[model samples]
Target: MDTRELEGFLAQHAPFDSLDAKMLRSVATAATVITFPRGEQILDAFTDPTNAVFIILSGRVDIWNDADRLREAADESLSAGELFGFSAMLTERSVGPRAVAATPVTIARVPAAAVAPVFASRPGARFLAETLLSTRHQALAAPAYSSVEELITTAPLTVEPTTPVSEVARLMTERDSRYAVVPGPDHTFGMVTDSILRRRVLVEGLPPATPAREIMQPATATAVVGESAQEAQITLLDHGSDFLVVTDRAGELRGVVAPRDFAVSPSTAGVALNEQLRRAGTAEELDTLARQAPKMLADVLGRGLPSGRVIAVYSSIVDTIVRRAIQLTFQRHPDLSTEAFTWLALGSNGRREAVLSSDVDSAVAFVDGTPPDEITRYRAVFAEVDEMLVGAGLMSDDHGASARRTLFARTNADWRAQATRWLAAPTDGNGAMMTSLLVDGRPVHGDTGLPEVARVFSDLRRHPGTMRLLLQESLSSRARLHSMRQVLSRRNDTFDVKTYALVPVVNIGRWAALSVGSAALPTTERLRVAAGSAMLPRSQASTLIEVFETLQRLRLRYQLLQIREGIRPSDVLVLDRLSAIDRTVIAQAVREVSSIQRRMANVSNYVPTADWSSTDGL
Candidate 1:
């Protein structure tokens, strides 16, 4: 290419586009055109350090972080007229990213020496300043503390239960504290805060002479010192409390910590958002707060919380919102509140692996003798609750997995009978699907001791045919790892991470749990229990557990990124967007899932061959 043409190309790209004609001519004169075939490493931070920045003349380049670390996805894919290799030159750091040709590539390399003075110019300096600021902001964004113990600023002030409210307030004022802990009978404790005093004493017109215990709110939200700060954030969100009590290993109170104490923290933001959720008296108000959930997930995950832990935190918030919705509906229909029923969270929410985009898969189980009239009202209340959830950005399950659906909402006796019918003929009328959903049903609200579902699962050992059918269903969703290379190369192709990776592991976990008579809800715990019972080898279980987490992390990161970009979040992930390392990891995960499914195809050894009468308990 001509020097004039190269200079024009440089003028079309950033930072360099701001360069003067003289500087551009100098860069073009000093440039060397190099051709790298597909799959060639153009620049490596660890080896072959280059002092020149490459301007892509043609083809595509994928800029990636260290491949060994699996630290993050590809930084970007650069096409014609785009630049790479500047970060290493700008920072003079060896720890820079690797750039590879995703296609056969042609590039013009401009020496760092020639570009140095160009970058020092006015417009170039402005671009450099912005880049530096972004780097600095990311560094400062890391959470300052990792554990709940580190967040406690001071020792908790304790007062006797008999102390007057005024006396407790005086003590708090003297100590410059905003809270006082009041110990109760049997090592239980309650908290009296500034808000409590204002709400209970000033607004309610309670006497100043009232006992501290009278105004104290139960300190049900407590965290251990060793617990992760993310866990504390979830606890605060779950309880919608202003503060959480941190305790030592001996179960003694250590200190009181409030979200306000930590400035510009994810924990603080989560608590504040959840407080709004709790105080929302109307569905619209709750919906507005609930919409911030994706942002919360991003913030929490950005702070380096594990993917599984972040999902758990998200699910807890969803539970709080669902419970609050139920509360609001019951408040509106007091007649329905009199019914004895348990609200069941099914599917992903039931397993506590809920994503923000997941539909509300739920049901309701009533006590045997609830009046028919009351049952009608209960159904209406739950339907309203479903509408409220939808209003709050949670979609209802499209497959009729809701309390409003007559098939799902039933009395305890009905549930037992339904389970029996499903077990009797697993292929009849979506029996397999119903079993998969209800097997993991966990009570999210109301009377939670509904044993119909668990009792049915416990008796799964007696029905070997049903167990085999369930195992077959679990193996049905297999991934074709052989075609992953072709799939990953297609720029516009997308795949559902949940269906391809996550569901297979979840299905296998569920089947394994039934195999061992374990009722573990979380996928990880189910795999652990299966391993413990020798139903699955410990190594395979451990690998599958890791694979499950990897898929979940990728799914969540993709959805959150989409949400940030103002795009509607979903389960599908673009193949070309994945880093080379991520693609490799996912391919390995697919292979493992496929391998396990193949191994379990021989159902005899997979299921215990014990005599049914001898192992009746299991």
Candidate 2:
């Protein structure tokens, strides 16, 4: 490569631009020359190929490979100002644009080892690296949250100096937290974690002979105290710690802060809902306002609340919103008050498995002999509130909603008519199917005196009834899967992810809930509430929740990653991108769902298992 050509090229990119004439010459002098024929496939998506930075001289290049082929060709053609194959030059992988000459091309190759000097000399190099690291940088919208700190919680956790590791572990367990900071003899603190036990005692074969100080992370990494939850989250992310200890002005630890504490922070969902409940005037306003439940759910999950508390906090928030929404609706349509009523929370919201952006699955009810005006009030309020939610970007379930038909109505007569028509008239043909969606509903607001509704649902379920019919509808759709527990992909390709692996768990949960008139829709809680009493084994119930949550987390993480990548967030996850561990977990989750579905099928439909795994495993 000519020294002048190298000087001109180095001067163009910022990190490189800062180089003096002498250094530029040095770079150009040391630069190796690599030439290629007019065409080449440089890298695969999953693997990196090059070990040097590529600078184009006389020829052009194309980027992409069939495997890591981000593009079939140079998705964006590079000219003199543009650097191509830089990732290959910078790192030990096949990365970046596959520099294929549009015609015969001349290029400069800078060894990977030398790239760091350019970075060290010019901070701009760091920016360039990150920019190239992500291809679709233009599409990455600013984060919705105000700051990154809003999601981390590296607050220091401290305990009394006398607290032993056993007691520390007990506190951590009771709090469902992982790490604890122990009180120090001085102002400095000692810490304890399960990792210490595993690494020191178990792995090193050492006894509990050493004090916790031998292994504790220094408190220096945690928040100083009184910082916002956002700052706490940042401290945690920066420190990779889960628990934080809040201190007072004097620097004495006052309380322990964990992910859950941050999630239920006063300024966010819990506080906002509390404030709204006081100010809300009409039921329609309340319901419309409740759309923030998803926002709160996002915040809860964003703060990295653990699974159980995440579910618990989110459920409580949704329940609060539902009640508040209904209360405001009634205020606006006072005539609905004539009859005792219940606002049933169906589907995920009912069972406490609510997530951000889930839909509204609910119906209204009144005592059997409701007056016509009450029905009008209830219907009108629901209509207004439902439309408000749609306008606010909160979706309603697909079966139907308050906007269409007479879905939100008053009276047990109305519900009875709907349920009876589905079971008896069966004209809808999708009766058992639709009923399953409705069956998991638990009253959220109004005169939640809904035992009658539960009884009616349970009776129909036990009869020559909807239980088997619902089971068949759900299972038949999932039958003929290629693997016993795996989602059967399509004949051409396998996208049977949600249909086979996820829905079955949810449907079985619905059936179980209906069988017991469970007060919840979420499979886990329904199973929990119904355990022993509903003839459900506690262990099985717990396992089912784990299965459900695993699927839910996978789906959630997939969506979050898409959002990060500037890809459209969709339920259709690209399985190839998942880690090997994640893929295995997903497969296991799917299989668990399958096993539970199989058990439910055999039990409900009296189908004899050809093999023993279904029954014996259960």
Candidate 3:
């Protein structure tokens, strides 16, 4: 191949693509073209190190973790433009996996010494390190249970809207039930419970002649009988309701299922934990409950609950802990009014996608024109909240940039100014970072100033320049894949599921949502909106959503394992620990992310003329 052809090939791939012109030319010159016949053994870990990186030009190679058990063990394959053998060169240790040409292959043999200068550069170094060491694991399959009907113990007590409150109470008492479903017009049902009887009737001095409907609270949610218990649990949790009316296909109320029914025992840690969190009055008491979180997670997973539902439950618990912390903070500083500011959960927590491994990312947006003295007191309140949260085992943001910090905590006017500055210079690194955080902001406590925040983001979407900048930032991280060869060459045991798989999907979904001015916060919801609006093709969006969910499930499962082993949960996963099915799922998910990235590139076309040069480099 000519120098231009070689350079073009290098520029088309990663690490090399990040290199400057001079470095690219040097790499192209130093690379030697080589070919191997089909079935040729390329490298064996038992043999001496190759001392070179092999970048495929054509054909294929099969990599196996165990050469002797190649067919039975987890393996991967590599195609054109993929590099391998670098880990052996860098570590100077015998590689762990064996690679063989799966088809007649052509490759460029780049000596490690020749690429030394490029590796010395920061981008190249980080890329190579990530490629070599990062690994991930998958969750164990949960037991499959059939339906919510199995959890229902008794028939629902139904009553008419005009039934006397006295008669309804008498029937509930006779049935030993705390709740009764009052049928409403148009096939709806209202919930009348003991709590309502106490608070709305006796406490308010309501007459016994008051109708049942007058004291009933409308059911916010319901579940079909044949649905899985996990699905029912999710429905109940999503609506923040203690109980869900179970219905038949005809929509007739059959029974009720509460969150407690899913627990293995009456005092199952998962059920008891929530009660403990609600009653927790001190940081120490909350911390004690927090320690039970891992056990609760394990219990839920053991019951074969769906991963999405598991995350929802876990997030609910975390939310309770955080809100309780805020309540405690207020008790410590009675002068500070919660109505003066809004506490926002940012990042994964904000999106309601948090797992055991998640850290706290939060901010406070105060009401306009708060007194300076009160602002100072509010800062102290926020700081106390953060301290209590951290003490209860929630990891704080890396820079401690929560509501306690000036950067995150700001008045309504200050936030508007910040948003304007960010939109005006969207490509500025700091501005871009802040914009990403703002996109995921969710109000957890106090007055929700989210409408004002949403308006700012919507305005950014209205501007062409802002859309272009967002597209650029979202495309900043490409999905990383290791060919069979690359996987075999590495000594590291863990993979970074977040950086390689999860983050790319998140960024793509975020950009797509913002491009269409979507108000969706969760990644899956954003993709759904994008697809519905034709911002993303339905087929592609569906695939991307499925892939994102799969990655999340795997990450949650891995974190559960870490917690069981008495280690701090994190994103790094052990590939060898995964089942064959999981490995296959992960490989397919990686490819799906790459495909989405390419599709997104084709769709983003509104680049600013002045930034065209920078865009070309990316």
Candidate 4:
């Protein structure tokens, strides 16, 4: 385009529009037009730290941080008139993002010398400074400690339970330590620390020869060796202790971690909330914990943890709270045998995708044919547990679909019968809902009888018609994508992301897994399993997983904001509230979901062989 045309385009776009005619002409005159074909690398930060500012004059360019492995979807596509490559110029730092021509693109490259003159102008300087600051803020939000192993210290001081208190103190003194680990009667590690010696030994005038086990705190906190530092931190604080016993995958004790090791980080409110729930011997304590959950959620989100990992941590915390409530309920009703029944977390909890505002979707599955009196006692226990959960901020399902309802608290035989009925008449509304719920059911407590449930699910997989019906149902919802004209015309609107993005991805993943008789409940795992078994294309699976994680992060940020503002969280996200980068990511994710649906439509036609029982494929 000519200089006049370039000036007109610059006048219509952002910060350039704020420039006076003199400054605008300077920018337009200095702009050199460059063209890149589709699939061409435009710029790499590592090799090309171009000081020139890039404005997309036509077509599209995708900008992404190549170094950001945690943020797989941290990409933004800019079309005509959008500006990029300004941050490097303003901050005087190396360009951190790589750019590529997503489509055949023409870009205006204005020299750093010319752009420097614009920065002297007040409006232009303010805009550049704000953009630079925003970029820095986002970079800071990325995860600091990738894994908990980073925090694991060397082996902690160990002592036998038979060791005398005097001996334990001497060992601690020699080691220059404040704590020691002792073997518990329950075969778990117990903690002996200076506090116990000061409070019990000295204050109570106990003999120095008393067994260390008598005063050591029972082992209540532990984390897998591979868990994230954030998870370990939450666990330690949740148990109201500074220390945690780190264990390997085999449950063998590895080492101990303490808050001081990590510089004595401030106690997170979420951890305190978990602690309260665990120690909640009474209903009132649960109520208090529930009320504090929103703030705790706000705190965790504020810490800038990755959204997917944050959800996992929050889900685990919720699980612990729910499980504790069940334990407390069993204590109240001693007649109930915890082994006879299992508590099943359904919906988001079952999939481990739960967010701040997720509702309780759970049920109870008991062994077949318990005595009537014992059944009565089990019903009471379920009722109490449900009440506790509701009180702890997990509102029950509106349709009375929880363990508190008799419909869900069924025997193994009953669930099998229900599964059979649902498969037999898969198109029915109730059947579809039940099928969706049962597909995601995960045992959270007690004897789950999962093998029998898995057997029934495998049997359902034998019916090709059932798989066809589920695939159709899964694709019923279309992705929420606006036409180009519609997107350009709309201003400041919000939509329910759950309906448009999350549900469709979840349904498709579930369909893919069940078609191949894979029992992986989590959506990401389901996609991985489907890809591994060649049921779905690996490339498509990877794209779908990326889209799913992006949508999840967006939804979580929106919900956490709502929680922080004292409003109940929801899936609706205001487009105006998101950063320009985030808006582009969301749009890309939605398009990807649409692509996955089309692929699912093609895959739905294939029917597995009658003898295809491939549980081990994943």
Candidate with maximal lDDT: 1
Model 3 alpha-carbon miss at residue 122, Å: 66
Q: What does candidate 2's lDDT look like per residue over 1-618, in tens digits?
A: 577777787788656777777767777777876666776543332255466666676666664422334445445566554555443343333333334566666677776566546643324434543453232321111112223233233444455655555556667666544567767655565556667756766787754445556657665545554455545544442233445555655767655554333332322223334234334565445555554444444555665655444554455555655555555555666645634766677666666666544576777777778777656656667766565545444457555634223554547776776676676634375676557656666666655454344556665434544455554665665522345434334432233445656667676556556555455655666656655422245566677778777777776656556555766445555656778897787677766666655655555544432221122333
Clashing pairs in 1: none
The lDDT values for all models are 0.76, 0.54, 0.74, 0.72
lDDT of 4: 0.72
Would you list the rank order by lDDT, best first?
A: 1, 3, 4, 2
Model 1 lDDT tens row, 1-618: 889999888898777887768888999999999999998888886454468778899999987644444356666788998776665565444445578899999999888898777654545644543442232222212243367887775678999999999999999888767789998776678999988999998899999899998989889789998987778877775555777888888788888776543322323334445545666888888888788788667866875677888798788878889988988878887655534888889989889899966888988889898766777767777888888998888867656688877778888888898888898898997899888999889887766553587668777877888877887888898755434665567543666777778888999898888778888889999988777443467787898899999889988998898888988778877878888888888878988988877776753454464431122222
TM-score of 4: 0.59
- Give the Å shift of residue 484 in candidate 1: 14
For model 4, the superposed segments whose C-alpha errors exceed 4 Å read 1-146, 150-227, 231-253, 256-270, 328-334, 337-339, 372-377, 420-429, 448-451, 459-461, 481-492, 532-535, 579-581, 606-618
Q: Give every collision pair in model 3.
A: 134-495, 135-494, 135-495, 136-495, 136-573, 137-573
The per-residue C-alpha lDDT of model 2 at residue 232 equals 50
Per-candidate total of colliding backbone pairs:
0, 35, 6, 0
